[model samples]
Target: MLALPASADEARRSGYDFMSRATRAMQDEDAANTGMLWVKDGEALWNGKAGGANRACADCHGDAVASMKGVATRYPAFDARMRRPVSLEQRINLCRTEKQKATPLAHEGPDLLALSAYIGMQSRGMPIAIVMDENTKPFLEAGRETFNRRQGQLNLSCAQCHEDNWGRKLAGNPITQAHPTGYPLYRLEWQGVGSLQRRLRNCLVGTRTQAYAYGAPEFVDLELFLMWRANGMTLETPAVRP
Candidate 1:
C-alpha cells in the first residue's frame, strides 16, 4: 500500500534498500563468491598479449589503476557519434574493434562479461556519477518517461513495483527500484554474473516490454535512468543478489 514520491530517484533508492535486505534473506553468498571468477578471467584477458598487434589491455592501460577506476561508474552513457545511448556491452565491443583491433565479443559472452565485471569491480565504493549534461539530458528525460509509462499485459510501469510497492513481496521477492550501481551483478537466483543490460532486459521481460536487444538504446536509457536515480549509492559491482 505504499506510494512513490514526486522524485522518482528518491523513491527508488529508498525502496531498493528494503528490497536488497529482503533479497539477501532469500539468497546467499553465491553471487558474491562466484562473481569473482569473471573478475579473474578479465584479469587474464587484460594481461594476455594476444592479437596480431601483440597488445594486452595492460600494454595501453597499464595495470588498470586509473583508467579502470571510475570507468564503470559512468557507463550506459550517451554516445555522441551514434547520437544515442549505448550500454557498457556496446562500448566494450566498440573499444575492442576500434582500439584492440579484435573481434567484438558477443553480448553475453564470457569475454564481455568478464571485462564488464572487472571494470565494474574497479569502481567499488565509488558513488555513481551520472551526468545529465546537454548531450545526455534528452536521453535522461526519455528514460524517465519510459520508466513511468504504462505498458505490458499487466499495464504496470517500473515505478509500480520498484517505487510504489518496494517493500511488498511479489513472487517471493521484494521489488526493488532496480539500481545499476552494482551492475554486472552476480545473482544467486541467476547462478552467475550478468551485465546491467542483461539485468535491464530481465526487467523488461518481467514487465512484458518485449525485451529490447541486449544493448539497445531503450535498455541504455533505462540504465541511465536507474543509475542517475542511484546517484549516491556505493558501487557494489559483482555484488550478491537473489
Candidate 2:
C-alpha cells in the first residue's frame, strides 16, 4: 500500500507522482510522449483557416506561446453570457460558433482534442488558478456537492476513492488524489488522447452509473470542483498515463 501524505498541505499530489518511473519518463520526454502528436495536429489546426470567417486562431490570438500562457489555469471560468461556468472545450466551441461562424466541433473528436491539447500546452507548468467570486460561488458549491454525493449501484462518490482512499491500489493501479492538471492527456489504455470527461465517463461506467452526455453542465461543474481542488498544482498538458 502507498503511504498517504502527512497533512492537508502535503496531501495534494499530482497524478504524476503515482506513475511508475517508466511512465514518468515517458511524460517527461516530448519525443516519447504520444500526446505530442495531438499537440502537433492542434498546431496545424490553429494556423489553418477555418469557418466562414476564414480566420485561423492565430489571427486573433497572435502567437500562442505568448497569448495563451497561463490561460488554461483560469478556465472552467464564469461565462457572463451563459451566467454559469463553462469548460475550456465549451469555450472553444463558443468561439467556433460565435467568432468564426463555424459549427461546433464534435465532443471528444480529434479536432477538438487537438485544439484543446494545443491550448493547454501553452500553460504547461503554470499553477491552476481559478478565481472565486459571487457569480461563481453557487456553481462552486454545486461542484463540491457533486464531488461528495454518492451515486451509482456501487454507491460511490468521487471523494470515497480520491479523497479518502487515495494512495491505495484499485485493480493494481495506484489511486491518487483526483486532480485536473493533465487534461486532454494520452492514456495507454485508450491508445490515443482523450479529455477529462472521457475519463470521468469511464469511472461512472465502472461504478455502474449512467454517465452524463458529453458537454453536460454536470460534467463542467464537476470539472470546476476538481480544478479548484487542484489549485496551485502545475499544469501538465498531454501527460502520459497507463
RMSD, model 1, all Cα superposed? 4.3
Candidate 2, backbone clash total: 0
Whole-model lDDT values for every prediction: 0.74, 0.90
Q: Note the residue pairs that clash in candidate 2.
A: none
- In model 1, the runs with Cα more than 4 Å from the true position are 1-16, 19-32
- Residue-wise lDDT of candidate 2 within 164-240, one digit each (tens)? 99999999898988897799999999999999999999899998988999989888888888888787789999899
TM-score of 1: 0.86
Cα lDDT tens digits for candidate 1, 1-242 = 12224575454453225545555543235443677788889888888875656668788888775789987877777788988767777887877777778887898888889988887778988987776677887888788888898887678888887767876789887666667667676777688888777776677787777777777677778788877777767787767666
Worst 10 residues of 1 by lDDT: 1-10
TM-scores of all predicted structures: 0.86, 0.96
Position 34, candidate 1: lDDT: 70
Residue pairs in candidate 1 whose N, alpha carbon or C atoms collide under 3 angstroms? none
The total of clashing pairs for model 1 equals 0
RMSD of each: 4.3, 3.7
